[model samples]
Target chain A: MSFTLRFGPVFEAWRELAAGVWLTLQLSASAMLIGLLVAVVCAWAKVFGPRWSGWIVNVYVEVIRNTPFLVQIFFIFFGLPAAGIRLSPDVAALAALVVNVGAYATEIIRAGIQSIHTGQIEAGLALGLRPVQVFRLVIIKPALRAVYPALTSQFILLMLSSSVVSAISADDLTSVANNIQSRTFTSFEVYIVVTLIYLVLSLAFAGAFRAIDRRVFSYPVAR
Target chain B: MTRFPSRRALAGLALSAALAVGLSARPAAAQTVDEIKKKGVLNVGMLVDFPPFGITSLDGKPDGFDADIAKELAKSLGVRANIVPVTGPNRIPYLLTGQVDVLVASLAVTPERAKQVAFSDPYAGIRIVVYGKVGAAVKEPADLKKFAVGVARASTQDVSLSAIAPEGTNIRRFDDDASAVQALLSGQVDVIGAATPVVGEIEKIAPKGAFDTKITLREQVHGIALRPGQDDLMKAVNAFVAQQAASGALNTTFRKWLNTDLPELKKPAI
Candidate 1:
C-alpha cells in the first residue's frame, strides 16, 4: 500500500497547536513552582515537625505517589464535582499536576533533609541564627541543592505527563493535536509533529533547570 | 550541566521514530468476493460496544443490527459469517488492512472516509441530536451559548455542533461517547450531542424523565465498507443492500434492535 504523508493540514492549524503549547507551558510552569512550595512545606513537616503532621504528610505523599496520574486528574475533574467542588478543565489539570508532583518532590526533598547532620542545625544556632533562618539558610538550601537534579527530572516528567490532562478535555498540546487529527485524518503527521514539540518542550525545560542549578546551587559550602 | 540531547531526549526521539515506522507500514491487500468464497467465511467486522447497531449478546456472540446485516451479507455470499468485534476508531484500519474482508461496522458514509475505502449504499440510519437535562431551555444551537455542551471530540456530532454553535458556546469535547454521556449524567455539562441509540442507552441508565432530546443535529447513514478499488466486492455489497431494502428484511432487523421502523436509507453524496 502506498501512503503519502501530508503535513499541510498540521501546519495549517499552527494557531491551535501554538495555543496548546502555551496552555501546556502555563500548566507545567505554574505546577512546578507551586508544587515545589508544597513539597518544601511537606518535607519540613515530615522530617522535623510534630508526629501527627508527619503522619498526615506521609498519607498525602503515599496516596498521590502510588495512584496513577490519570486517575488523580479524573478524580479532581470528574469525581470531585459529585462532592460539590467543580473545577474547569484547565484549573483541574493544574491542580492535579500540583498535587501529584508535590508528593514525589516531598519524598525527594525529605531524603535530602535526612542527609543533613543534626550537628549542622546546632552549629547554625551556636552562630546566633534563629530557627526559621537556620532552617531556610542552612538546612533547606543545602538539602535542595543535594536533591536539585532529582527534583528537576521529576518536574520534566510532570511536564510530559501533562499530556494526559487532555483526557478531561484540557486543551493541552495533545488534545489540540487530537482535534486536528480528527478533522484532517492525518494521524501520522499530527502525532509526529506533537512528538517533536514535546521533545523540544522537555529539552527547553531541562535547559532551564540546568541554568537554575548553576545560578542557585553553585555556592561554595563550608566544610 | 548535562550534555545537549540528554538520554531522555534521545529516548523520546527513538520512540517517535519507532511510532512513525509502525504507522507508515501498511500491509493492506485487496480482497475479492472470490477470495472470501475460497475461504468459506466472510470476515465481517462490527462494533461490539455500539448497542442496537452493534453489541455483544448475552451468549457472548456478536449480535446487533450491524451483526444481523453482516450475517445476511455472508449468507447471500454462501459463506459462514465470522463476526470480528471492532471499535469505532479502529474499524476502518481493520477493513483497510484486510484484517476483515469487509466492515459491516456502523461506519457512517462521509466524503472524508471515501478516500480510504469504498462504501456500499447505506443500510442503516441514525439521528444525531442535542440531548439535555429536562429543565434546560435549549431549543436550538443559538441557545447553546447559555449551556455547557459535551461531545465526543472529532465525532460527526462534534463537527455538526461546532458548525452550528453560537460564538461563546462552551463545548466540552471528551475522548468518546461514554465520557460525554458521563459528563451529562454527572451534571458536568448541561447538554450533550449524541446519537439516538446512545440517548436510548442513556435513558436506560439515567433516571426516567431526567433528560430528553432537545434538537436534532443531523441524520447519518451507515454503509458497509471495503478497501478501495474492490469494484466487484462493492457491486455485490450494494446489490445485497438493495435486495434487503426492497424485500423489507432490513426493516425487520432495524425494528427488532431499535424498537422503531428503520429510517429511510439513501446513498449519501460523496
Candidate 2:
C-alpha cells in the first residue's frame, strides 16, 4: 500500500498550530491551578463552614456537575454577553473550564477532607493550634495526600475536555486542526497528526504529575 | 509472547490500508450526455441547507433556486431531475467521484476549485457583505476594527472577511450562516459577515432600518460543475444555462424562491 500522507502543509502551519497548543496548555494549566483552589475552598466550606454556606456549595457543585460542559461553555461565552459581561474566547474558555473542573474537584476534595481522622484534628486543637493552623496541619495536607491521584486524573480529563471550547472559536489545538483540515481537505492526515500531538501532551502531563507526586507525597512520616 | 497487533488485527489494518490506497487511485469517470440519456435521469447535486438558493420544500423534497435551475436543465435534456442533496465541503468530491452527474450547489468559481472540476458559464451570483444594526457607524473593514463581527466558520465570507479585517477585529465564527444570522438577531454580535441572500432573509424578520449592509466584501459568481473531461455534458450544461439566462426563465425562478430578480452573472473568462 503506497498511500501518501502529506505533513508538508500541516508542518508549514506549525507556528499557528504550536501557538494553539501553547494556548491549550496555558488555558488548562491556569484552570487547573485556579480550579484546585476553588475546590479546596468549597470542600472546606462544606465540611466545616456554616450549614447555609455548605448548602450553597452543594447546589453549585450539583448544578455544574450535572450539566454538560458544552452547554456550560456556551452559557459563559454566548449567554453571559447578554448580561453586559462580554469576555474574549480565551478568557471565557478559561472561566468555563475552571467552573466545570472546580465542581467535580469539589466532590473529590470533600472525600479527601472526610477521610481525616477526628482525633488528629482534636490533637492539633489540644496543642493550642489556631483553627486555621489546625486545618492546615491536621486535615488538609494529609487529606490532599490521600486524594492526590484522583485529583490529578480529574485535571487530565479537564485538559482533554477543554477541546470543546473550540465550539466557541477559541484558538485551541483542536480548532487549529479543524481549520487546517478544512483548508487543506486532508481530513485524515490532519486528524492523525493532531491526535498524536494530543497523545504526547497527555503523556507529558502525566509525567509532570508523577514528578509533582514524588516531590510532594514521597516524604516518610516523622514517627 | 503475543505480538502487539495480534496477527489478525495486523491483517485487518493492512487490508483497510490497501483498500484506502485503492480508493484514492480511482480514475475520474467522464460522465457523458448519452449515458445520462440512457439512464433517463439526471442526478443533479444541490445543497438543501442553504436557503433561497437551496432548501427542502414543505413536502420534504429539495426545492429552491438551484433546484429550479436543475429541473430546467433536466427538462431541456428530456430527463427527470433527481435532486441529490450535498453539502458544501463534499460537493466537489461528489462530482469528481461521479457520485453526482453535475453540481448546482451554489459553488463559487474559484481558481483553486477549477483544477478539480470543470465549471460551466456563470449561472448564479451572490454578493457577500458586512451587515450590522443600523447606525453602528461601521462604514468599511477598517471601521470594523473595534466591533465583534460574526461569520460562519471557514465559509467564503469568513475567508474574505478575515483577509480584509484588521488584526484587532474579533471575528466570531458560528457553525453556519443560520447561527451567524441568529447571533445578529439576538444582539450577541455587533455585526455579521454573510451573503446577500442570507441577509435578505434576515431583513424579512429584523425591523426595517434596524440593520444595513456596512460594506460589500466581494461578489462571487457560481457555476454548474461537471467532472473533468466531460466535454460534451459540460457543453450541453453551459448551453442550457445560456438559454435559461437569455429567456428570463432563471430570473423568474430566482424571483419565485429568492423574492428578487436573478443577479446578473459575469461569466469568468474561459
- Candidate 1 local lDDT, B103-160, one digit each (tens): 9988888888888788899999999999999999988779999999999887778888
TM-score of chain B of each: 0.83, 0.83
Give DockQ for candidates 1 onward, in order.
Answer: 0.54, 0.29
Model 1: DockQ vs. true structure? 0.54
Candidate 1 docking classification:
medium
For candidate 2, the per-residue lDDT at A30 reads 99
User: All models: lDDT?
Assistant: 0.90, 0.85
Every candidate's fraction of true contacts kept comes to 0.50, 0.24
Question: Which digits, one per residue and each the tens of the lDDT, describe model 1 over residues A1-223?
Answer: 4668999999999999999999999999999999999999999999899999999999999999899998999889888989999899999999999999999999999999988899999999999999999999989999999998899999999999999998888899999998888788787789999999999999999999999899999988777
Q: Total clashing residue pairs per candidate?
A: 0, 0
**Candidate 2 ranges beyond 4 A from true positions:** A1-4, A117-128, A184-186, A220-223, B1-50, B53-105, B116-123, B166-170, B182-189, B224-253
Best candidate, TM-score: 1
